[model samples]
Structures are given as C-alpha cells and as structure tokens.
Target: MYRSHTCGELRISHIGNTVTLAGWVQTVRKFGSITFVDLRDRYGITQLLFGEELNKQLDENPLGREFVVQATGKVNERSSKNANIPTGDIELLVESFSILNKSAVPPFTIQDDTDGGDDLRMKYRFLDLRRNAVKKNLELRYAVNRSARNYLHENNFMDIETPFLIKSTPEGARDFVVPSRMNPGQFYALPQSPQTFKQLLMVSGYDRYYQIVKCFRDEDLRADRQPEFTQIDCEMCFVEQEDILNMFEGLIKRIFKDVKGIDYTEAVERMTWEEAMWQYGNDKPDIRFGMKLCNLKFPAHTFPAKESLSSLIAGDFAVFNDAETVIAIAVPGCAEYTRKQTDELTEWVKRPQIGMKGLVFIKCNADGTYKSSVDKFYSEEKLKAIADAAGAKAGDLVLILAGTEERTRKATSELRLEMGKRLGLRKADEFKLLWVLDFPLFEFALEDQDGGGAGRWVARHHPFTSPKPAHIETMINNSPKVADLDKYLEHPYAGIKANAYDMVLNGNEIGGGSIRIFQRELQEKMFAALGMDAEEQQHKFGFLLGAFEYGAPPHGGIAFGFDRLCSILGGSESIRDFIAFPKNNSGRDVMLDAPSEIAEKQFDELSIKLNLK
Candidate 1:
C-alpha cells in the first residue's frame, strides 16, 4: 500500500505508531538541520518533520510544492503544537521517503485567496479546485444534492431521466441546436427543461416524477447565468397549485436544514404579483429589510384595484407631472447625505443602464424639517405630505425616480436593492423565502410577426400554463386582438391571471411552476393566443395537444435552478464557483478550448455550410 493512513489522520493519540502516508507537498520550511513540510490531500493537511539525517536526503532530492510523495514515519507528538489544524499536535518523523510524481510550478498558488486573476485560475481550474475554499463549495453542492434526493425519495418521487435532444419549439430564450449527420438539413435542439416530457409522464400515469437534470439555453451570460445549468425538476399529477407549493416548499426548507443546519421553521411569506409590484416594484422582493416602494403616481390599469397615492406628489413640478409614473423609497438614516453624495446618486440614476433623466430626493431631518430638490415647486406642507406618503421617518432619505411606468418602476426596484446592499441589509447568512402568485397569464410583447402594427400577446409563463378558473371564461370569450394600440392594458385578456407561482429567496427567483392546461380546447386556445395557427401548433406541439385528449389529469410542477441554489447556499454570487469545469462568461471552456470549429469533412457529412455574416 502507498499509505497506511491519510496525511491528515495521524494525531496525538497515534503517537509512537509507525505509519505510511502519501500526499502532495503543501509547503516546506527549514530550521538549521531540521526541515518541516506540510502534506495535503482531499481531507486535510498534516505536518511532517525531517530530522538532521533525513534533511540530508531532502537536500539531495528536494521535494517542491505540489510534489506528490510517499513517506513512512513514526507519529510523534509535536514539541510545539499548532492549535489550528486537526493533526497539529502530532508530526510524522520521517524515516524514509520517495517522490511519487513531480509537478511543474502551478500558474497560481493554490491558496484560499490566490494571487491569480480569473482567466488564469479558470485555465488552471484543476489546480484551483485543490484550494480549501473551492473544495468547500463543491462539498456543499454534493450535500445539497444528497439532501434533495433524500427528501424527494422519502416523498415517493421517482428519479426519471429524460432525453437531452428534443424538437426545437421556441418558448422564451433561443435554443442551442445540434446538427444531425443521420438526417441532412435537420437538427435537434437541447431540452431547455423537461416540460413536455414531464407532462406526458403525468398523462401516462406516473404521478410523481423528478430529475436532477441539465438544461440548456442559448442566452446572454452574466454573473448568475450559465448556458448549460442544472435544475431540481419535478412534476406531479392530480394536484392543484396548493399541492405543488407545499411539496417544493418542503424541498427547499429541507435543503436548508440538511445542508446549512438552518431550521427555517417559520411559515414562508406570500404575496400576489400585483401586490409585489405595488409594494416592492418587483416580483422577487428581498424581505430581509423593509424599504418598500411607494407608488406616488402610477397607471390604474397596471395595478387595477391598488390604491393610488398620486395626489401626494400632485404639484407644479413638470418632472412629476409629465411622468407616466412616480415612485420612491425611503432609505433609513441617510438624511445627513452631503450635496456631493446626493449628486453622485443623481449621476448613478442617469447611467445608461438606469436611463433616468435625473433623481429627486427629500431629506427628512431629525429635527422634523423636510428639505427637497423640488421644494421650489412645493411648499413645506406639500413636501411633508409627499414624505408621509412615502412612509419616511425622521432621519430618512427619500429617493424618487420618474419616467415611463415600466422604466420608473424597474429603476426604483434597482435603487432599492442597491441601497439595501449599501446599507448591509442583504446579508448572505440570512435567508428569507416568499411565494409570489397570480401573475398575468399573458404578456403583450412587440413582435411584428404577422405584420401587426403594434405587438402580440405571448404566454407569460409558457403555452402549457392554465389560466385561472375565473379568468378562463373571459379568455375563451374575447379575441386577443387589440382595438387600440395605446390602450392594450384595457383589454380583458390583460386582466386574466395564471394559476402560477414563483418562489423567491432573498430577491432571487429560485423556482417557479404552474398548473398545466390539460383539456384540448383550452390548450388550443392558449396556442392561438400566442399567435400559433392550427398548422403551426400541430407542427411544434401536436404531440402534447394530442396527449391532452387522452384523459390527462390535472398536473403541476416546479424546477429549481440547482446551480443557483448551490451558489446561494455557499454564499456566492457566481454559480461557476460551485460548478466544476464551468465555462467562462462567454460560454467558452478555457481549459479544453471548446466551442471551436469542427473539421470540414464533419461539416460536409452533416451537409451544413458556415455562412458567417
């Protein structure tokens, strides 16, 4: 055997025991004739001592950092014990040693806080994974995976594998296609999610099904996004929205307890989509801190029954007057901001991404006086009314953004998150979960596919989602066509809600699902509403529609972004850290140099031509 015990196994209890150990050299130090070396493996590290005689051997055949070696030694108690490591109290006094393998110096030091940049580390990811921090992330990911499997198995959910290659039916994001050599001029698109297959399984009488599956989408990349990612996908039949909420809620809470040792026993908070937009300006609201958006002016159609506080900011101010909406958030304890600091905030809102003309602020001083940029247009009483409308307290700063309804609401949400981060309110250790329900069943996107002058109605979730029972009648009765372009929101279809729900944790959408349309008539109507004609729907989703005609039961399911979950649990912003051999931001495998060109012969076999634009 190369070793009797791991490099990290010998302890004070094993003192005087002769053992063989093998590992990579971590660090080497010399004290006159005596030499010390730290040996590391996957488990942990242990220090080794080379006496005067053995030091001579090391001097002749020196063991460098990351050199694989084996050593036979007596476990002796250390003269000076290190309180940090587990085996610090014992040192292996080496009698003999052999070099197993030698390594060229790594491009980066394999330390928790390495000196290498991102590209260098990615290029040497195998070396990077040896670092303690990265190892911990992978360990956490495995724990979460094991925890999820245990929870689902206990709940009678079967792990079912699905096909990776499927017909390309464009739903939201673009699909990554694989050319078929067997059939020229044909291709297969990767499964974005096992949506149709899971539904089919339910129709075929598999009540509970799941897969820790890989999903792909050809989309823009960012810190949280990856082209190919994993999901904890699940589906269940003969269930309502309530059943899905309870089942998947249990999964997440169990992951928290099993992986993070967090109890999370409290009930998760719930809100409607309208209420979320009205209160926080976003569906995924981080409830760790309460800096809810105050809608001073907004369109009635957007928040149909929501109370309007537009009268509070009604004045001679043209910015507020001309704006489609006015929104504000009262950031606590920022009333003492200097003019320069406030101007900096103004410029921040004016950035191209934010696309705001300017920012308006109201500083509620501790002495109960109000100071505002728009004070010229409004009196002290008027300014106080606006502050009161925004729920501002003494020593609070109210930041306002005004423009089009969509832009203003989105900008306000961004500002709220930014402020929360600045104030250290978005803590990594703390977790809060919420369920936002009753999303608009369909959204009107500006797609001129039919040469329609304005836009068209697309399914907000997917074509398979069922409309809310009350809203189904209106959907079937009214035409999806808009009579007036400016008044699209006035259509009855815009008022319809889906039987869908999204689970949000700490301002990130972790999972979502909807009760599916099982009846052929309703499913066809949904397809039609998405502008798919009979022939087109038949070509893309005829199989699914046909399956619905065969006594399909009511079903719903949820898919949690497994990578995002691991990253969140590991207190990381980027999912790549939790993933092994992950592609870089441009979706290129730097280590393997993938997504490269294939041989011309291979392309000819597939009968494809590269027409670079």
Candidate 2:
C-alpha cells in the first residue's frame, strides 16, 4: 500500500506506530543537519522530520515544494506542536522515502497567501485548489449540496435529470446555441433553467421534482453573473405560493444548520415588491442594516400611496423641482463630514455608472442645527424640514439624488448599497433572509421595440408566470397598447401584479419563482401581452401551451442560484471562488483554453461557415 494512514490522520495517540504516508510536499525547512517538511493531501497536512542521516539522502535527491513523495516512518509526538492543524500533535519520523513523481515548479505558490494574480491562479487552478483556503470553500459547497439533497429527498422531492440541449426560445438573456452536424443549418440551445421541462413534469403528474442542474445564457458577465451556472431547480404541482414559501424556507434553514451551524430559528421576513422599492429603493433589500430610502418627490403612478413633499423644492431649486424624482437616505453619524468628504460623495454620484448631475446634502449638526448644499435656495427652516422628512437625527447626514424617475431610483439604490458597504453594514457573515413578493407582471420594454417609436410590454419574469388572481381579468381584458409614450404607465396592464416571489439574502436575489399559468386561455393571453403573435408563440412554446390544456394542476417552483448561495454561505463575495475550474470574467477557461475555433473539416461537416463582422 502507498500509505497506511492519511497525512492528516496520525496523532499523539499513534506515537511509536510505524506507518506509511504519501502526499505532495507543502513546504520544506532546514535546521542545521535536521530537515522538516509539511506533507499535504486533500485531507490535511502533517509535519515530517528528517534526521541527520536522511539529510544526506535529501541532499543527493533534494525535495522541492509540491513534489509527490511516499514515506514510511514511525509516528512520533511533535517536539513543537502546531495548534492550528489537526495532526499538529504528532510527526512522522522518516526511516525511508521515495519520490512518487517529480513536478516542474508551479507558476504560483500553492499557498493560501500565494503571490499570484487571478489569471495566473486560474491558469494553475489545479495547483490553487490545493491551498487550504480554496479547499475549505469547496468543502463548504459540498456540505451545502449534501444538506440540500438530504432535505429535498426527505420532503419527497425526486432528483430528476433534464436535457442540456433543447430548442432555442430566447426570452430574458441570449441563448448559447450549438450547431447540429446531422441536421445541417439547425442548432440546439442549451437549457437556461429547464423551465419548460419542469412545468411539463408538473403536468405529467410528477408532484415534486428537483435537480441540481447546469444552465447557460449568453449574457454580459458581472461579479455575480456567469455565462454558465448551476441552479437548485425545483417544481411542485397542486401547491400554492404559501406551500412553496414554507417548503423552501425549510430547505434554506436546514442548509444553514447543517452547513453553517446556524439554527436560524427566527422566521424569514416578507415584503411586497412595492414596499421593498419604497423603503429600500431595491426589491432585494439587505435588512441587516437600516438605511431605507426616503422618497421626497416621486411620480404619482410609481407609488400611489406615497405622498410627496413637493414643498421642499417649492423654492424653485430647479435641480430638485424639475427632476421627475427626488430621493434621499440618512447616513448615521456623518453630520461632521468636511466639505472634502461631502464633495467626494458628490463626485461618487456623478460618475458615469451613477449618472447623476449633482448631489444635495443636509447635515443635521450635533447641536440640532442643519447645514445644506442648497442653503442658497432654502432657508434654515426649509432645510430642517427636509432633514426631518428624511428621518435625519442629530449628527446625521442626509444624501439626496434627483433625476429621471428610473435613473434616479436606480442611482439612489446603488448609493444606498455603497454607503452600506462603506459603513460595513453589508456583512457577508450576517445573513438576513427576506421574500420580496408581488412584482409587476409586465415591465415596459420600449427599447426592445424594432422601430424605436414606442416600447412594448414584456414579461417581468416570463410569459409562463400567472397573474395575481384579482388581476387575471385585468390582463386578459385590456390590450397591451401604449397609445402615447408618456402615458405608458396609465395602461391597464401596467399595474397588474404577478403571483411571483424572490428570496433575497443580504441584498442579493438568491432565488425566484412564480405560480405558473395553468390555463391555456390565460397562458395565451400572457403570450399575446408579450407581443408574441400566434405563429411565433406556436413556434417557440406550442408544446408548453398544449400541455397546459391537458389538465395541468396548479403548480409553482423556485430555482436558487446554487453558486451564489454557496458563496454567501462561505462568506465570500465572488462566486468564482466557490466554483472549481470556473471561467474568467470574460467567460474564458484559461486552463482548458475553451471556446476556441474548430477545424475547417468539422465546420464543413456541419455545413457552416464563419462570417466575422
């Protein structure tokens, strides 16, 4: 046998026991004639001692970092123990050793604190995985996976595999297409999330189904996004929204207990989409902190129940008065900020990403007086009123942004998140789970129109989503027409809410799902609302519509972003860190060098030709 005990298994209890161990050399150190080496494997690391006699053998065949070696030795108690590792109390005193394999020096040190950039580490990912830090992340990921599977299996959810290659029906994100060699000029698109198949399973009487599946989408990448990713996809028939919420909450809580040792005894919070947007300016609000947005002036249609403080900008501050929306948030204990600090904040909002013309501030001083950036326009009383409206306390700073409604609201949300980050309020370890529900069924997509004259309606989730029971008639009765561009918000279909919900963990949308439209008539109406005429709908989703007609049961399901969830549980911001052999930011596999060109013969076999633009 190559080894009797793993590098990590030996301890003081095994002292004087002769054992064989094999692993890669983690580090090597010399103390005069004696040499010490740390041997590492997937399990853990153990210290090895080379006596004076073995030092001569080492000199003849010197060992380097990451060299694979096998050694037979007597397990001895360590003279100096390393309390950090499990096998710290014992060392293997080597009697004989053999080099299993020689390795060229790695491009980067395989240490947790290795001096290597992202690209270099990605290129040598196999080496990087050997590091304890990366190994822990993968371990945590596996634990989560196991916990989820156990929970789902206990709840009678079957693990069903779905096809990876399916028809291309582009909706939200572009599809990654694979050309078919046998059927020339035809192609197959990768399954984005197995949405249709899961629904079909529900119709075919599979009451509970689940899959830890891979999904692909050709889209612009970000820190949280990838061209291909994993999803904890699930669907259930004869269930309502409440049943799904309770079931998935149990799943997440079980994962918390098994993976993170967090009991999470308290019930998860729930907020309506309107409430989330009104309070946090984001549907996925991080409830770990309290920096809720204060809507000073906003469109009447956006928040019908919210009353605007029109008097604050009554003094003709055109920046605030002329803007379609005005929003602010209080920064706790920042009233004493200097002009430089506030100017820096102003520039922060003016960046191209934020796209704001300027920033307005009201500093509620410690002495209860207020100082303002628009002091020239408003009196001290008016500034105090604005500060009071924003819930600014003594020694608080009120930051305001105003512009077009959409941009202003989005910018304010980004700024709130930025300030939350600055204040260290968005802690990765402090997880807060929330369910944001009742999203708009349809979002206006004017830019997606071909003629660029007026925008058309598009499914906020997808056409498969069922409208809220009360609004079902509203969607079916009204035409999805916008006679005037400015009056699009007044359309009857614009106000309809869907039976949808998103689970947010610390401001990131971890999962989402909706009650599906099981009725053929309603499903067809949903398609029509999305501007999909009969022919197009039949070509893209005829199978689904036909299935709905065949006694489909009321069903709903959710798909959690498995990678993002693992990262959050691992206290990491980058999902890439939790993923093994992940593609880089540009979706390029540095190690495998994938997404490369194919040979001419292969292209000819597929009857395809590349036409570079």
Candidate 3:
C-alpha cells in the first residue's frame, strides 16, 4: 500500500502506532542535525521529524518544496504543536524515507498568501490549486454540488443529460459556433442552456428533470461571467409560478444549511422589476444595506405615476433645466465631507465607466441648514426640500447625478454601490436574497440586424417565456410594431409583464426562470412579436412548436448559475476562484494558450475558409 494513513489523518490518539504516509513536501526546515518537513496532501498537512542519519540523507538528496515522498514513521506527540492545523498536536518521527519524485522549483509559492501576479498564477494553475485559499474554494464548490444533488434527489428531480451541440437561436448573446465536418457549409452552436431540451423533457412527461449542464455564450466577459459556464438547469410540468418559487427557495435554503451551516431562516425578499429599478436603479440590487434611488426629474413615461421633485431646481440652474432626469442617493453620516472630498467624488463620477459630466451634492447639516453645489440656482429652502425628497436626514450627504434617463439612472446606481463599498456596508459575509419579479415581457430593440426592430419587439428574458396571465390577451391582440419611435413605451406591448423571476443574492443575479408559453397560438404570437415569421419560427423552434401539440402540460422551471452561486456562497467577488480552470477575462486559457490557430487540413475537411479582416 502507498500509505497506512493520509498526511492529515493521524493525531495524538495514534501516538503509539507506526504509520506510512505519502504526500508532497510543503516545506523543509533544518536545525543542526535534525530536519522538519511539512507533508501536505489533499486531506491536510502533517509535520515530520528526521534524525541525524536521515538528515545526512537529506544532504546527499535535499528535500525541496513540492517533492513527492513516502515515509514510514512512528507517530509521536509534537514538542512544538502547531495550533493552526488539525494534525498539529502530533508529528511523525520518521524511521525511514524515500524520495519518489523531485519537483522543479514552483513558479509561485504554494501557500495561502502566495507571491504571484494573476497572469503568473493562471499560467501555473496546478500549483495555484495547491494554495489553501484556492483549495478551500474548490472544496466549498464540491460541498455545494453534493448538497444540491442530494436535495434534488430527495425532491424527486431526476438528473438527465442534455446535448452540447444544438441549433443556434441567438437571443440576448451571440453563440459560439462549431463547424460540422459531416454537414459541410453548416455549423452547430453550443447550448447556451438546456432551455429548450428541458422544456421538451416536460413535454415528454418527465414532470421533474434536472441537469448540471455546460452552457456557452459568445458574450462580453466580466468578473461574474464566462464564455462557458455551468448551470443547475431544471424544469417541471403541472406547476405554476408560485410552485416553482417555493420549490427552489427550499433548494437554496437547503444548500445554505448543508454547505455553509447557515440556516437562512428569513424569507427571501421580493420586488417587482419596476420597483427594483425605481427604488435601487438595479434589477440585482445589493440589499445588505439600503440606499434606494430617489427620482427627482425622471421621464414621466417610464414611471408615469411616480411623483417627481423636478420643480425643486427648475428656474435658474441651466444644468438641471437642460438635463432630462435627476437621480440621487443619501449616504449616511457623510455630511461633514470637506470640499476636496466632494470634488474627488465629482471626478469619480466623471470617469469613463460612470460617464457623467459632474456630480451635485446637498449636505443636510445637523444645524437645520442645507449646503449644496447648486446653491447659486436655488434657495436654502429648495435645497432642504430636495434633500428631504431623497430621504436624507440630518448629517447625511445627498449625491445627485443628472443626465439623460438611462445613463443617469445607471450612474446613480454605480455611485450608490461605491459609497456602500466605501462605508463597508456591502459585507461579504452578510448575504441577502431577493426575488425581482414582473419583468416586462418584451423589450423594444431600437433596431435589429435583419432590418426588423426599432420598430419591433424582442423577448426580455427569452422567446418562450409566458406573459402574465392578465396580459395574454393584450399580447395576442397587439401588433407589436412601433409606429412612432419616441412613443414606443406607449404601446400596449410595452406594458405586458412576463411570468419571469430572477433570484438575486447580495447584488448578483444567481438564478432566473419563467412559466413557459404552452399554447400553440400564444407561442406563435410571441414569435411574431419577436419579428420571427411563420417560416423563421419553423426553421428555429419547429420541434418545440410541434411538441406543444402532444398534450404539453402547464410548466415552469429555473436554472441557477452554478459558478456564480458557488462564488457568492464562498464570499468571492469573482467566479473564477471557484472554477477549476477558468479562462481569463478575455476568455483565453493562458495555461493552455488556447484559441490558437487550428490545422488548415481540419478547416478544409469542414469546408471552411477564414477571412481574417
């Protein structure tokens, strides 16, 4: 046998037992004639003590970091016990040892606090994985995986396999296509999710089905996104929106209990998409701390009934007068910010990411007086009114941004998050769950590639999502064409809500799903609304459309982003730490040096030619 016990398995209770251990040498230290080595394996680390003879053997063949070795030793209590490790109270007095393999010096230190840059660490990912930090993340990921599988199995969800290569029906993101060698002049796109297949499973009378599946998207990359990722894709038949919500809520809570030992007893909060946007300016708002958006001069059309304080700065300030909308957030206990600090904040907003001309602030002083950047244009009373409108209290600072509707709202949201970060409000350990519901069924695309949209509708979530029960008639009756571009929001299609829900943790969208359109007529109308005619519908989703004829039951399901969920649970800002071999931000595998040139003969076999423009 390679070993009688693992490096981390022995303890003081086994002090008299002789054991054989095999692992990599984490560190080697020598004092006079005795040597100490920390042997590390997947389990844990155990210290080893070598006598004079073995220390002389070490001189002939020195033990280095990350050398594979096997040692037979008598377990003994340590003279210097390491309180940090579980196997610290005891050490192995090595009787004999053999060096199985010697390793070249690692590019980076294999420890918790390593001396390596991101690119260097990524290049040597195998060594990076040996770090305690990375190992814990992967362990947590595995634990979450087991928890999810156990929960799903207990709840009667069957694990099913789905296709990787499928038809490309691009929606929000582009597809990563693969050329088919057998079918020349054509290509297959990787499944973005097992969306349609899971729906087909429901049609196949598999009421409960699930897959921890791989999905690909040719999209912009970010901290939370990947070109290829995993999803806990699931579907169910004979279920309603409420049923799906309750079931998945239980699954998430179970995951918390099983993996993190957190009860998560509090109910997951809920908000309409409109409410989320209006109150926080983000669909996935971080609810750990609240600095809700305050609308002052918003466009009347977006929130027609939303009260506005536009008149507060209407008269003399050209900045307020010329701007389309004004939005603000109150930062608690920041009223004493000096002029330089506020100027730095102004410069912060003007950065390219924020894309704002400047920033305005109202200091709600403790002495019942208001000081503001726009004091020249408005009286002290007007300033106090604006501050009060934003729910700013005494000693609170109200930060305001004004611009066109979309940019200003987004900028205000970014500003709120920055202030929260600065004040240590967005705590990593404090998780909050939210369900943002009632998203608009169709988003109006200004103009689509096939000369269709500006004038046409696109699915807000996906084409198959069912409209709200009350909005079904409106969706079927309306033409979905925008005769007047400026007044597109006035269309009845604009008001129709989807039966979709997104599960938000902290500030990230970790899962989303919708009740599907099960009726043929309604499905057809949804296709037409998305600028897909009968011929295009047949070409794209013909199989799904035909499945509806075979007694497809009412169904709904959700897919959790497996990576994002793991990252959030692991208290990480980036999903890369949880993923085993994640691509860098630009979607390149630096270790493998992938996305390289393929063989010309292979391209010829697929009858493809590259026009590298």
- Best-fitting candidate, scored by lDDT: 3
CA displacement after TM-score superposition, residue 155 of candidate 1 (Å): 0.2
Instruction: For model 1, give the 10-residue run with minimal summed lDDT.
Output: 445-454
Each model's lDDT comes to: 0.91, 0.90, 0.91
Clash numbers, per candidate: 0, 1, 1
Tell me each candidate's TM-score. 0.97, 0.97, 0.98
lDDT of 2 by residue, 8-90 (tens): 89877899999999999999999999999999999999999999999999999999989999999999988799999999999
Cα lDDT for residue 31, model 2? 91
Please identify model 2 stretches exceeding 4 Å from their true place.
Answer: 449-454
> In candidate 2, how many Å is residue 26 off?
0.9
RMSD list, candidates in order: 1.7, 1.5, 1.3
Better of 2 and 3 by lDDT: 3
- Estimate the overall C-alpha local distance difference test score of candidate 2: 0.90
